[model samples]
Target: MNLAEKIDKILANEVPFLEVAIYYLDFTVYFANLLFPLFLFLSVIWFTSKLANNTEIIAFLSSGVSYYRFLRPYMIGATIVCIGAFFLGMYLAPIASQGFNDFTYKHLKKGKKAYENTNVYRQLNENQYLYVGYFNVTEKTGTNFTLEEFDGPKMVNKISANRIQFNEADSTYTLFKYKERRVGEFGDELISEAKRDTIFDFDLDDLTPVKYIAETLNLNELNDFIAREKEKGSSYISRYEVVRYKRWSLPVSAYILTIIAVAVSSVKRRGGMGVNLAIGIAIGMVFIFFDKIFGTLAEQSDFSPFIATWAPNMVFAVLAIYLLRNAKR
Candidate 1:
């Protein structure tokens, strides 16, 4: 459906074909990063269940192979998959995530509904602060913008504009209906102008930035971004922290899911492979549900991002251990 919608847009010339193709590639990478662990779990369950059904597992056991010895190959396979997933989360997926979101906002949606942070408040530095009531990224404009400068908790100067626009050609900001107030030792000096062009220390990108911008950065970049956001006391820092912790959590989940899948499918039963697959799918869905719930909590509430990211893995790891113990008998 997503592809079809993009294709329709392409046919209507609403979006460029090359852009859609690039978005499609990026989307594929992002989806693979999310689903590969689940797919590997299912694959292990299917393959091992087949072996069990064919009596191959029984034959091996009868030939004096311990269950622990039998698990060595599966653990080795999981280790390989875990390493791949780590690379995807740490490096490749971030690049794809950046491209995917960029295309979605810039071309596919045309920046119609892309601004999540409509009213932005940020302390640019110890002395400078910025506020924007509304920011239109497509037009590179902000409405009801105000910037204040302070010196040791004392307000020094303030600039207010009805509208501010970013000029790409000259890389400057043009403030319309601008007003400025400067605090003097004697009194306050006020100035008003119809329009003013001034260069600010910040750019349009600093205004109402995307919440998931951290997801687009590699590990090193993400760490730096989080640090910067923390220094600025950004409310969205939790969202960034969630993404950072999730990179490690996702790779660890592969081993947990693998153990659960193997334990649930190691025994041959009346319904054969389908039963195992059904159970595996159900578990996968539940795991996803837990992950999403905790992730949202971290993003929207004051939940600890580290705990939110790893909660599902921790819960399921215990389940995997219990199931593995039962299966060993």
Candidate 2:
């Protein structure tokens, strides 16, 4: 079997039914996301072409109706679509993403050497970090692990365990068959061994770094995640932050695209829908490319994430307004 087929077999064998449902839900959401914007772009072109072909646009203009007035209904329709997109991105997405990640970790590649010698690590708080040499969420435990709390330049507390169990019931971590060392300001270290459960007030979700790898997270989760990562001063957090904000900002781009598509395609042409669809898709791609490019630049430079994320939308919206006004003239 190939790599993906092998991975699918492992997931099917280990993950729970509910978890699988969430994964499929996430897949659905991603599929919807990929198509919705293109559909909106096409709708704009189609409607505009219909108006032109039916001679309704010409009749409206002759009867003292301006292009601005003609676009009123279309704008309202686009606004409603944008609102739906907003709700999807800001609310339903987070829970679905969390469930999907849980399934992937617990079910996919369970008990298999999926990532050999790869210890997934994450900083939980300032000077506090968790490391898992091998994790199997199905077992709710990780082996060859370390949880450390630092004081300035010195390690103040350290927990070295053979396995750390996730207390999903309490949403915390319990170190099992573990030994812990505590060092004070004077460097006198105290060590203790525990065979039973040792509970620490650390959120296991934070330590499971792969949770962010899922593409379906909503704005709230993304915002909270970025803030948490930023506080820990983790490397590559800025890039994720840019992505988080971009998700929210990018959806409203549909409205701007709608206007531009309407403006460009409203004029009657002998070239027909083929020409209009081509131009609309081309312009739509340019906007998308610019949006992505600016987001990358935001991560690499001093530009604010919000500005970089919204810049393309702002630029396109303004251009649409200008073209729209000219269309009336």
Candidate 3:
């Protein structure tokens, strides 16, 4: 459905076939990797429901196989999936995400800003701090800029400007209405100018990350990126941390969802496979619901990302335990 829509869009836009093919490949891989575990859960339910209907599960337990023993193979399989999912999400999905998002923005959503960070603040180092009221990534400019330097809590110098623009060609800044104050033993010396060009301790591109930048980096790169963003007092730190934590949580969810599927479908019911399938679908939707709700809360508010990332799994784990116990009986 999405492919068809994108195809129509690209055709109307006259986007090239090569770009479309690349987008299609990356688009398919990214979402498939993301939803692989959920699909695996339904597959498990289908297979187990069939086994139960055929009386194979009953025979295994009736012939002195412990329920735990019957579940051993499933657990082993889940472990393999867990590891595979971890590597794919950590290493490969980011590349696919980069391709997918890059194409989306460049062609599908051209001229639109992903988002802008306002009232941005950064601790350049122990001694230097910076602030900007608003920044433009494309223009490489900011308004109401301030940079302050201190030595052991005592102020050294402060610079303020009405507008600042980065000169990428020469690696300097052009400040409008520039003013500087230098704190000295005798007194503070003020320097004022209408316009000035100078260099700073930072680069504009380094200070401001591009949108969807977090989704394009591998694990190590992401960790380092988050550390820098934290020091910079980024308002979207929660969003970045959510992505990082989900990298770890995705694999763990593979096992949790698999166990739930087995427990839910390992018994024959009056309505047969369809009943188990309907139940499985409901459970999957509920899992997605909790995941999205908590994830949004963390991203949009001060909610803890850790709890948001894992809470759904924790809730479903308890449910899995309850269902497994019942199935055992």
Candidate 4:
């Protein structure tokens, strides 16, 4: 087939069917990806135009046999940018997006879910702490919880309760259906059948800043949270650790995207730079959409975060390298 035929075939394949949401989504992301490169390419053109307008190009061409030689450095720079964006978008972007989106959707959005608002653990001191089974933000109540005092890694006292309610008005916690036991230097004793409102002097630190859960964290915060959670025997720490690693991998995408842009738009053709930019945008969008889709796959299943994040970079890096070599020749 001719070049036109091949190009047509590729575009046809890229254009998604009207009936498929995934296809439309892919198109949306692909188009979005194209915008960055188009801007970059235009900026290149703008600079080139400035040089040409100011007679700089003429000066260079007057001195040298070919003006194209001056473009070599720009091409090399673009290549470096491409590689940087590719790594950033392909790996680092996905990871950052995962954490960033979760933090945004979970906390920033209105109408917080009950489950999201529930459960809080706090540290009162080196050896004293509290736990709430559930904290209902709407009702300002927590149910089925415990308060414990540890003396040098040994439990000295345990307080168990069927329900604890936080009085938001006074910033205090009240225990209901409670039992308290002490086994310290004074020896074992029990206090039972407690009913009170605002009985605890403890500040609402146990439940304040209600959005302190694991999902609200970025990569570094997630790492710190995981370590703290591990010390407390939190089973969810492993999951957060996986997410933390993924976050660090996201910034590499900017490099990956830069490569794809440069590789595709660097060509000089009779059809003009516009066509090349359009093509670059179309291809970039597809890759971006794929990145997000792969991310969702990782979230929904046991997909390797590294593979899911880096696959687009790998594929596009190969493609960019091929295109760059072809353009150079």
Candidate 5:
């Protein structure tokens, strides 16, 4: 289905054939990294179920290999998987995600654009603040733009404009109906102009209010971005924090999910491997559902990102413990 869709898109958009391979490779890496732990969960279930069905596990146990001793190899394997997942999410996945999103937005989005955040506010420095009522990304323009510089508690200079547009060529801005009120030592000075072009200290690219940007940034970039947003009082800070914490939490879930899978599928039953696979699928779906529900809650509300990211694993760890005890018997 995806191949057919990509073919249609390539023909419709006149996308170069060279880009097809690049897009697929980046997308594959991004998607595989994103679901690596989930894949491990299901694979462990399948392999353990097969072993149980063959009674190989029973023979090993009968030969005096303790259940905990049997788990040593699985634990080592899980640690390797966990490290690989961590490395991918920290470094490789971010680059792949950026490429995939860039390709999609450029070729596949087909006139769709990210909606500009409204009521945008930023503190440029300890004493300077900026505001834009609305920004248009396609046009690189904004309405009701204001910049104010404060001296202690009182505002010293207030600059307002009816409209503002950024010039990418020279890294400057053009402001229409510009007015500046300056509080001088002598008295108040007011300057008004039909148009003005000036440069600000801040970068508009850094201030861009685009969604899903956190996912495309590497660990260092994400950390810096979150800190910058926090300093600027960005409303989407919670969303970025959730992404940050999940990078760590998701890799750690490899251990939790592995333990659960082994305990659930290592026992022989009348129905054989089929019954164990059914149970594994159900558990995997529940784990995914909980992660999504809580992660969305953290992004959309005031919920703690730490708890949102880790709660699902914590809940399933108890289930792993219970199942492990039963499997021992």
Candidate 6:
């Protein structure tokens, strides 16, 4: 479906050739994280079923090989895949995620309003804080903007503007209907201006923050972001936490899915490879369904993000163990 959509865009000349190439590359990287485990599972089922049908597994058993011994090679292969997936999840996927989103908003969603978080609050530094009631990234403008400068627990200056526009060429901000207040030990002084142009310590990226900004950050950066969000009492911290925990959970799932696939297809059946593939697909769908449900629950409700990220893996791990035991017997 995704490829078809991109091809349609190409045929219609809706996106540039270079952008289409980058989009395909980014989508491949992003989907690899989701599809690799499923592909591995299906491959394991198919290969093992072939061996079973050929009596290779029975031959090995008759040669006094223990079931666990027979499983060593499969486990080793799963470990290699797990490591690769870990690397992708921790490093490459974040870069690809950012590229994918950038391309999407710039080309596919041209002239459409991107849903940016309204009423953003951020600590620019130890002594400065910023706020914006609403910001439009495409327009490079914000409404009801404010900047407060503090001096060791006391706000020394405050600047508020009805609207602020960012000048990309000059790297400055133009404030309309702006007000400034300076607090002194004795009293406060206020100044009003119909229009003002000044340099802000921040930039356009500060004004337009992405909701899934967490997804674009590597693990170390994500941890730092989540810590800062926690300090600020951010309500969306759960969403970031979900992305962080899923990085670990997804790689670990490769091992679980590998074992489940082997156990399910190691015995030759009357229906053969088709039956094994059908079973594998069904299991894969169930795992995805559970993952989506728990992830959505965590984002929408008060459910623990750690639990939500790991619940799918835990459930499948138990299933793997059960199947392994049966297969061994």
Tell me, by TM-score, which candidate is best: 5
47-87: candidate 6 lDDT, tens digit per residue = 99999989899898889999989999999999998999998
lDDT for predicted candidate 3 compared with the true structure: 0.88
Residues 1-329, candidate 4: write the lDDT tens digits: 22243345435445333423333343344333334444555466545545544556557656854534765667677667666555544444444444444433433343655243356676655687777777766677778788898989888888888887877667766789888898857688988977755466455544543332543454456667667656654434434544554443433444445555545554444555556556765776777687678766775676776677677767877776777566444
Cα lDDT tens digits, model 1, 239-321, are 88998998999988999998898899998889999999999999999999999999999999999999999999999999999
lDDT of 2 by residue, 236-287 (tens): 5656767677567757888788889888888887987778888888887888
Please say which candidate is ahead in TM-score: 1 or 6: 1
- Candidate lDDT values, in order: 0.88, 0.72, 0.88, 0.57, 0.88, 0.88
The best-first sequence of candidates by TM-score reads 5, 1, 3, 6, 2, 4
Q: Give the runs in model 2 whose Cα sits over 4 Å from its true position.
A: 1-26, 95-121, 131-145, 152-155, 159-187, 190-198, 213-226, 233-236, 294-304
Residue 123 of candidate 3: its Cα lDDT?
Answer: 80
lDDT of 6 at 28: 95
List pairs with backbone clashes in candidate 6: none
Clash count of each predicted structure? 0, 0, 0, 34, 0, 0
The CA lDDT at 279 in model 3 is: 99
Where does candidate 6 stray beyond 4 Å?
Answer: 11-14, 112-115, 149-156, 224-235
lDDT at position 203, candidate 1:
58
- Per-candidate TM-score against the hidden true structure: 0.93, 0.71, 0.93, 0.51, 0.94, 0.88
TM-score of 5: 0.94
lDDT of 5 at 58: 97
Measured with C-alpha atoms, the lDDT of residue 18 in candidate 4 is: 41
1-329 per-residue lDDT for model 5 (tens digits): 67787788778888877787889999899989878888998999999999999999999999998999989888999999988889899888988988898888888886776544467888777788888988877788888999999999988999999999999999999999999999988899999999999998977753457777888899999999888888776778889999899999998888999999999999998998889889989999999999999999999999999999999989998998999999899
